[model samples]
Target: MNRPTLTRVLVANRGEIACRVMRTAKAMGMTTVAVHSTIDRDARHSREADIRVDLGGSKASESYLNIDKIIAAALSSGAQAIHPGYGFLSENAGFARAIEQAGLIFLGPPASAIDAMGSKSAAKALMETAGVPLVPGYHGEAQDADTFRAAAERIGYPVLLKATAGGGGKGMKVVERESELAEALASAQREAQSSFGDSRMLVEKYVLQPRHVEIQVFADQHGHCLYLNERDCSIQRRHQKVVEEAPAPGLTPALRQAMGESAVRAAQAIGYVGAGTVEFLLDARGEFFFMEMNTRLQVEHPVTEAITGLDLVAWQIRVAQGEPLPLTQAQVPLNGHAIEVRLYAEDPDNEFLPATGTLALYRESNPGPGKRVDSGVAEGDSVSPFYDPMLGKLIAWGEDREQARLRLLSMLDEFAVGGVRTNLAFLRRIIGHPAFAKAELDTGFIPRHQAELLPPPTPLPEAFWQQAAQAWVRTQPDQGLWTSGNGLRLGLPAETVLHLRSRDQHQVVHALAATDGQGIRQGETVYVRWEGEVHGVSLFDPIAQADASHTTQGGLTAPMNGSIVRVMVQAGQSVEAGTALVVLEAMKMEHSIRAPAAGVVKGVTCQEGEMVSEGSVLVEME
Candidate 1:
């Protein structure tokens, strides 16, 4: 049968994944159409496309996840194919079926395969029947409190409650004891419903000291399928992967071949085409259990491409156009090592909370040979609260593991972000850890090194204060007379006072100059190098709070820009320390605001389902 050509493609996604797919599609000479939300009209991915379609909403449900809007955009843009890039509607079987029924190419596995593995419970049951090794768990169809509780009891304590249709760690909770099971299950189900529209959960025994390994499998319509090695995604936080590396550090030839073959068998059994990842939990005894399979291209696919020199996006498009597999399993090349880190716009010090602000100073690492930076936002762009907080990805490839590791570390150092808190420094620590260097990996990697990874807060040094003073001087025309051309102050010591802030700490220091000799200004920020270290400080303009309506002397305020999902306590309610008062959700993660002390709630100012600003008072305590 002759297949229709796919020359024009519409990417039905947003952010870095959209940009990544567009790059490959454009390189393949296909016209790329980008569908964007109202908030992302000027985003990097929107600008990367040949033609843009406005989805006309700020939220994911109103825009990207709306199958009708995506289909209409593809049809109106004169595109012949649609690529669902990794999230949102990528794993939605109904969306895939709609695209195919509309006479457009769906650049992924068939809707049948998507349905086969769409839910954790369904997928596990199917995998068990296929003779694939599965972790001991309950994949029952009944979705009730009593049923789940009984299942958890049978599975034993310390089980994991995972949303049946979850990805990216949204609907995952670990219940260490019997008492924690109820809250964990409820939160997991709520998050699962909010994110994936499925609240049904599956309970599984939590594995100890297990490495999260996944095999990259590709298949074509002509009965050709092969595995593209594997990736180690053991380093994770909050059930989401933070770092990934290709050719898992210490896999024996026999074990590697077995896993790869098993992944291929799994894909073939479902007639899966395009890119997919078969995840497995590797234990300390070298035993493995099948985890849920992701039927879409993974966020960490770049490492697989870097090591194999294969563009999985291009492969997806080609396979959708009825092309045969580009290479056989024997012909697949496994070259040098590659490592990737997901840089998120989040405050790791603040319990890994998502941060929202403009990218006042977003500088990406230079993408030299074997170095790649895939990002969706540029400098001056706003990091909104409507979506995931992942800012971009940094990937590096080198001749050896050490070379890759060292190069990645240098690239991370060069990558800078401003105007918002990020996990940049924390990522550096993970890569620099001695255990990481020696390839000691597991799901507990981050928790084991929490003290080293999350260092105690230290006060800013004198140099930081000095730099702030110098920056303040340069910004003031009247103060310029006090400093020399070389950034040194000719005036007396403590001639000026500097009010500076870092993260949330405000400091007042009396200093004269930013430096003793030299300094440079970039935009509103000034950089000073002293004592063999360079410090960059931005002039802080504190808002004059005339009314203070958003703040209370003794009140709990909203910690971020999010909606109040729940109010656990009401007005005049007595609460003890650590008692949850309100629950706030932002970027798909839930944060509970607890009572600061044993006190009576004077009033409840916020209500459930209402959007609140960062500093709006939620409840007052007296």
Candidate 2:
């Protein structure tokens, strides 16, 4: 049924996903309104939309996720619908119900579907009742230690403790042994309460070497539903997916058919309407178990879009407009390989801690034959400490997986970022890994190669020499280095030394080594000769504008701007290298900063009460 057209849509989200939805909404002839927080006033999404609404504060509670505020924005802007582009209130069933109550269309699954999947335990029960395969675990309300211990014992060791109310790798822990059960349980509860406002949890058998796969399904009010194939999201850290790909490598046709069927069945079971994702954990033996269902568009939906050549956002709007699915399941064609890597504003070397700062420069790689970038920031956008660390997603499609991976790697290497810390190298490393190339991955992929994935700081490549040389030449008044070498240096001999910090260790780079004609010894110090001024080049992390710093006696420096969420120790407290010093929340995820060296906490500069910028002193150890 082709119904009345929606004239306008309000994006009930900020950042990249908001920009993503706005692009499709505008292209589909719908005027777009962006709802943003004070921190996001200058956000790219706000600028891209036809109208903008300031939701007020930087914190999520004050803005993006505020259901009432979002509805008001939509109604005020004359938007006929609201598109929650993942996260925040996307899966909040109450939000959907509210939208319907307000007589506005929600471009997502029905409130019933959201309610069915909003609670993990409830969803599991629903899936189990529907005869869908599920991981064996306890989903009861027993929270006592003895009861939990008994349940764990029953489920056997290596069980997973997961928060029942939320997704994203938050509030989840893998217990490898009985000794860690209690701590894991408590931690899971704490994280759950903090993230989802619920402390309830459930346990399930941990599938070692399991693959994370999900199928995208679409449904309409006309009783038409279809599956859009599958996406492999096994490349993960902390149980949260970091990379996603369509047409999973090594996925046999038989397994794909089985997974897709299961996904459809799951959707049909919930009377799912609009777009939803059925996630599954595929074990080594090709056995798949339903993990949970995401009742909204996924962060990695672009891969599915690339392969099927279908615009999911547009489809979501059309379906909301009462249009039946245009294609049947049989017509949902899957073509080409598409991979997406999430570029985050986090320090990979520092336990992938969330980072916050201005994106001094944000550059998007041009979508060539098989590349696309969905971003919410432009140059000079500040990555606020209160939001998720993700800057944007870089997606590439190719005739095959290797071509896509290769293209993505090249794009990652060429991409440049100059503010705060980010994981460009980390992403490049994952794509470059042989196991990744061969699709030999599981949940344990990062752990098996943890050392390599987060490699210690090494010397910068000669390419740095070229960039610095060019920069220095440009700064010079006369001589262009590419043309003449004489103008490259000042007449007076000078030396500059920079102390670079990487992985919390300091290394001094001599910018210029002094020389006396041939060589000179000042007392016992010998000055050696070098060509031009020493560039002091070191490993340059994309988002980290400057990793070099001067060391002080009080505390280790905060590498980027952030707020201290938790201070684990006080002055004179003994600590170890990996001891949690303070927890910092930046770019929307929590970062547990550990001590860089084993020593006594001599001083602390960052307080739980104040905001600290990059390079601000945090805690000093003696």
Candidate 3:
């Protein structure tokens, strides 16, 4: 079969994936055309493309996901192929068929393969017919509650209720016992209807302590297929994968061969082509069951790329153009361990609610030895509420899993983001935990470490002194010294006092200045010293409340605002030091204010429904 060379390709998506795909296309000497929604006109991906086409609107439905607009953009831009990067139209069979019919190439699997594995229920049936080890469940069409309830009861307690049309941990719930069945069903149905336009559900026995492992498969038009090892996506929160690693730990050579064979069978069963993923749930006892197959490239594809040194996007494009598999199954070698952690614009301490804000300061740490940051937005981009909360993916590679874990943790600590709350610090702690280091991973890891993960906010003591020193240093004149209107303010004082407020805690520090020297203040109490300059403070601990007032020694009022999301304790509620006292929802996520020390809830100042702006007082604890 003769394949036409793609001179120009339109990337039908936005953000990091678009940027990632464009890199390979550009490297292959193909002109990259970027299609952007109105709001993303100045986006990083759009700017990187050879030419830009506007998709007319910001919302995904009107722009990125709109079939007609995307096709029109490609046609008008004189593009030969379209690359739908992962999310919008990436797994949509109809979209792929339409693209092909429109005299343009679709850089992914054939439409038939997408349709085969697109629907969860339909895919499950097909996998079962293909002799795959499926989790015991009811894939039958019994929508009535009585029928479903009876099936769930038969399957035993702690069964999983899932929406048939879509899977994302959304429209899904685990009923621990029979009494919670009705509520779980209703909630699942509601979410399913809202998410996928289908309330049809399926019930399966929930796999406890299950490890989420998925195999990456690549296929060509010439009936050739290969598996690119496996990724363990067990570290999850709210059923969403927070971190993923390739060559899943604890997999013996025997088990690796078995799972890889099963994955290949899954892809071959549906005549899958291009890039696809076969997911499985591995139990504590080493039993594995087919979960589902993602017809599109997954978000964690970087980990696979890191380990294999094979660019999956480039392969997808090649296979779509009727190219044969470059390497056979036996020859494809997996090297090095790789891990990817999703960086989200979220506050982990506050239920991991999504956050939206400008990228006040987006800086990737220098990767020492083995670290890679794949980010979408730059310093000035706005993380709008229009789509997924994920900002980017951080990938690390090492000769071994432990080295990879340590490298990832170090890189996370070096990440500094300001202007909006992020889960960077939380991710750092998670990667360093013993359970994760040992690869004793499971889907329940986050929930299990929920308490330890959110112990308390520890404000850096140096930060307070640093800020105070800066304020004091700025008070002196560049030439000599100037008085602050009062006669008592000209020369450097023998001693200076500053009061700093951090959430519910107040502290006072005293510093003595040197004559005409570095503007650092040295004090006797706690052997405090300040270095005149400020290092990066954006990654500092979050300001718990916007309205906290501290009686600083300098007597300056803190700028604080925002309504409280939760008051952890009532008036006179006794609490220990570091106990969460209140929650504030600001900039699209939640922020918890904890007690600085053991104290009673002296006063309750804010109500639940109250609208707070910048500096509203929330609670007072003694």
Candidate 4:
């Protein structure tokens, strides 16, 4: 077969994955084109591309998921290929066919291969023919709630409801009891319809204490396939992977071989090409079952690349060009351990609800040697609620698992994002947890250590106050009636006291100016290193700020950034404490806003389908 020339490739997606793909393609000397939504014209990925085309819509359906827009962008840019960097349209078999029909190379698997693995029901049946072990479940044609509920009963309690066409943990729910079956089924179906355009579902016997291990498989058109070891994605929240590492810890060599060979067999049966992942659920008995196959590069692919010293995206391009696999299965090396954690815009104290705001302060960890940060947004960019809330990924590699874990923790400490809530602290707690340090792995790792992971309020040290005071003192004019007299009672010439705010709490501390070291300045804030720890302090006008930390009981407000999906009560309606009032949907998940106390609804401030900011009042009660 003649190799296809990929002079230029259009990335038909947005955010970090697009940035990730562009980095490798540019390094390989290929022209890259980025197709962005209406709101993403100023995005980092668009600016990083050799050429960028506007997709002309803010939402996914009208832009990223629109096959015609992406195709037109590629053709207009004179690109010969399209790289659907995971998420939006990466796994869509129809999009792959459209690319092929346009005589353009799709830098992914063939449409046939995607079709074979797209649907859970069909994929499970196909795996049976391929002699691959699968989890016990009902992957039949019946799509009614009654049928699914009955199937769950047959599978016993704790059945998992999953969207047949869903990935990235969307449209998936765990029904722990019969009473929870109906609501879970409806929610899963609604999410499936919203996300995948298909509401068909499948029921599975939920495995207990299972480790999520997935094999990275690569294939070429000329009949070659290989597995690049395995990644342990067991540490998860809301069914989405949080921490991923290569060469799953505690896996015996024999078990690794068994899983890898099984993954290869599964790929061969589908005539797979390019990069793909076969996920599995492994139990305590060393038994494994096929979960699902992601027919595109995974979000956690960097960990696999870090361990193998190979670029999977480059391989995808080469394979799409009809080239042969670079190496055989025997040559695949798992040199060292690597770990990656997703950095999301979320509030851990508020149930990890997604947060969106202007990144007023953002500074990434410095990358050198084994530390890598793949991001799509820089400081001053807006994190909109229209897409995924992930800021980026932080990955670190070391000689061993412990080294990698410790190195990643240090790197995370160096990372900072402000003007919005983030899960950075939560990630630190997880990696530093005792069980995590001991390599005690399972799917329920997060919930198992939830108590230890939540932050307990601790008072700021005196050095932190000194750090803030130094920065604030420098910003102030030397001699002024208002500024010079901003101290405590009976204060002498040398007496200095500063009132400040840290993480939304008011602080009054005594801090004298220190003429020691320099502090790093970010925006209007200063980050100072004290006692071997970095502390960030920003000056705020006392008159402009309202102290709401103590008085949080006036009206029900939006807990995070989201749109009002539903309003359960009306104005003048009577409601008791804990009564549900409104539903907010953010990051593709729904959360109810309930009444704080028994009262009459004075008014409903927010209506359905309206976007609300964090802390925006939604309902007022009296």
Candidate 5:
């Protein structure tokens, strides 16, 4: 078949994936067009593109997820093809169909293929018909609580409820018993509806101690399909993958071939084209069962690329242009071990709630042969609450798993982000854990080792105080012997008392006139990096300290910036501690604001549908 004239391509997404795809497309000599929401007008992806289209909305529903807007952007930009870089509308069958109807190439599977596997329930049914082993559960079209309750009871306790229309742990919940079934189902459905515009759900048996292993499959229009080995994405939090490694650690050659072939068969069943991932729940005793199929490039694709030395994005483009598979199944290469960790702007200590703020100080790890940092934001960029909290990804490749793991640790240590809290330290602890080093991985890895990985905050050491003092001293105007402001006397070096504050802790450090330490001063705050950790230290001010000391003893506040989706408390209602008072939706996830102590609700400061900022009191108790 003659190659389709594909000189221009438009990316129908934003953030790291958009930047990632545009880089590959530009490298392939194609003009790249970027579509962005109003808030992302100056985003990295928009700036890097050869052409830009403004979709004109901050929320995804009005921009990225709007099929009409994306298609219009592609048409106006005169792009020949549209690449739906995963998330948003990547797996939406309607989006694929719209692109096809608009006379443009969709750099993904056929619309029919996506429609077949878009719904987890439908995908499982198709997998069963293809003779792929499945975990026993109910995947029928039933949204009622009673149906799910019955299914859970029949499938035994501990079931996983998932959104049929999407992945990414957005609409997924694990119910441990029958009593938790109704609430879990309702919450899962709400998240599903908000994310995919579909409230349909499926209940499946929660596999005990199962490893999440997935195979990357690729195909062209000519019916040639092959699996590009597997990745173990077992290290997860909240059902979202945290760490992923290529070529699952303990799989034998025979087992690898078996899973790979099964994944290929599953893909062929739907006439899948372009890139897709077939996920499975692998248990001890070599048993693996199909979980679902993601009909788009996965977030963890970098690990597969690292091990295979293949640019999956470039392949997606070529395949979309009607080319055949680049290599046969036997010719596929698996060279070395590779690992990837997601860098999310979230506070792990606060139940991993997403954080939003300015990127006061952003520094990526030094580029090298084996290290790669794929990020979308730069220093001074704002991390808004309107999108995913992930800032970027850190990927490392090495000759062995240990080398790859250590390299990733070093990379995480070198990485630093300020203003917004992040999971960088948590990721480092996970990678550096002895259990992870031994490859004792599973879906429960984070929860199992939570004590060590999520340890309580320790008091800042004296060395850190000294460093802060030195950093502060460098900011002084005068540095001469006679005019210095370092408590300078006639001859003796006098101690300068420096009052500093970090978070809620106040410190008083005394230091002599000395040189600066490793720190970056941003505004009134100084960020000091010590032993792989970044500490934000601010000079103590009486007024600011007094303002911070104002107590909210009986107030329940929003933990992050989001819209209030539900208010479960009234002004005069009484509640107990831990009672869910309000549900705030942010970054596509819901966070419940619970009552701090048993008391009567004195006031409901926030109403449903109101947008609130972090620390905004939602409910006042008395």
Candidate 6:
């Protein structure tokens, strides 16, 4: 086979991954083309590309996932290849075939390799045949409710249901008993269909106290394959990785070699080409079970690159041009420690539900050696409800694990965002926790330390209020006695009594001329950065509060912009305090609205399949 001359490439995805790929492609002297949905026309990725193609829709299904449109864009833009950056259609075999059939290179593994590992059930069977150890479970063809129930019983209590065609924890659920199997299965199936266009599922025994460790594998058409060390993605929430680090801590040389060899074998068995990841669940006894293979560059691939000082994206492009592997397994380098944490527009206090709003204020930590920020949004950019809520990622590298961890913490502190709720403070607390510093890690890390990590909300500190008031006063245009409400009297000291509101709490802070604090005033709200946390402070107006319309005592509103997927309760339905009333799908995940207290449903304001905005009333109860 002759090597294809690549001069231009098209990125058939959006967000940070798109930008990340374009950066490398451009550095290699290739003109980069970027495709975007209607909502992402002004997105950071779209603006950075050498050429842009508008796919003309807001939703992923209508734009990013539309195979025909993407192929047409690549051809029209004269791109020699298409890079599906890790999600959307990255793992779709048909997309790969389309690119090949269109006479354009697909910068990923072959279609056959994707097919072999596309379905969880099929992948498990292939691994079994390859003599790789697997967890005990049912990966059969049957998909009926009775079959799943029986399989759950056979697998014993506590089983995990996973979408056959899913990754990134999109269509996954854990059933602790027979009673939860049906609903969990239904929900998981719906998510799978919405996400991957496939609802086939597989059931397996849910492993407890397991560490999610995955090996990075690279291959070429020349039959050369190598493993680029491993990453421990044990810190997670909602089955999705929150933190990942390269060269898992406490892993012996023997264990690392064994796992790396197995991963390489798995890739070679399927004739995988380009960048891929083979995931495993490591138990306390040094035993590991095969999980699944991600057939494209992983979100955490930066950590691998940090340790090896190799660009995996560059390797993918080189492999697509019929080149040999850059390095052999024996030559793979394992340098220093590297850690990455995902920064998302989400509310950690609210079950980590995705938040959508403009990036009113956005600032990244100062860039230097060992510190990198991969992001696709900038200040004034709006994060819509149609896609993933990840704003970007923060990565740090150092000569040792402690150094790396501490650098990542400093990066997190310097990072700041506003206009939408985020998990910035939540991430800081996690990394600063003594347990995490001691290298205690597992898939259940978040839940296990929920008491410390997800503690109940407390009142704002007095110092914060003082800082807020000071910042507010400094931003005021006038300080004159007549123009400013500084309570200036002819004979007494001047002081300003400001009624401020932060979230649901109100405080009257007196401001005597104190030094100003760091803050930004957007409209009537002052976003103050105090003690490494951002607090939004607004002036409280009693008149407006009295005139505002109020909802019923038990009204349940949509948490964010989303489509109602299911309405579990109807008018006049009496429900317990925790009964689910509605389920909203946003950012490719579902969030349920439950009854706040035991009450009777007075009305169902929103019907199934209705689009709603944040704070839109969904269910009214009495």
lDDT of each: 0.85, 0.78, 0.74, 0.85, 0.89, 0.90
Estimate, for each residue in 292-370, the C-alpha lDDT of model 5 and write its tens digit.
Answer: 9999999999999999999999999888888898899999999999999999999987889999999888999999989
Residue 302 in candidate 3, Cα distance off native in Å: 1.3
Model 3 RMSD vs true structure: 8.3
What lDDT tens digits, residue by residue, belong to model 2 across residues 445-560? 98898887876756644444334333333333343333443443567434444443333333444444222122222222112212211122233343354556445764677766
Candidate topping lDDT: 6
RMSD each, Å: 3.0, 6.9, 8.3, 3.4, 1.8, 2.0
Model 6, which residues run further than 4 Å from truth?
477-491
| Model 5 TM | 0.97
lDDT, residue 485, candidate 3: 33
In candidate 4, how many Å is residue 193 off? 2.9
Worst 10 residues of 4 by lDDT: 476-485
Q: Candidate 3, residues 182-263: lDDT per residue as tens digits?
A: 8668767765654445688989988778999999998888888889999999998767788999999988878888988888
Worst window of 10 by summed lDDT in candidate 1: 526-535
Write model 1 residue lDDT over 122-159, tens digit each, in one string: 88988999898899889888878788788888889889
**TM per candidate:** 0.93, 0.85, 0.79, 0.92, 0.97, 0.97
lDDT of 1: 0.85
Error of 6 at 133 (Å): 0.9
Cα deviation in Å at residue 51, candidate 1? 1.6
lDDT of 3 at 72: 90
Write out the backbone clash pairs for model 6.
Answer: none
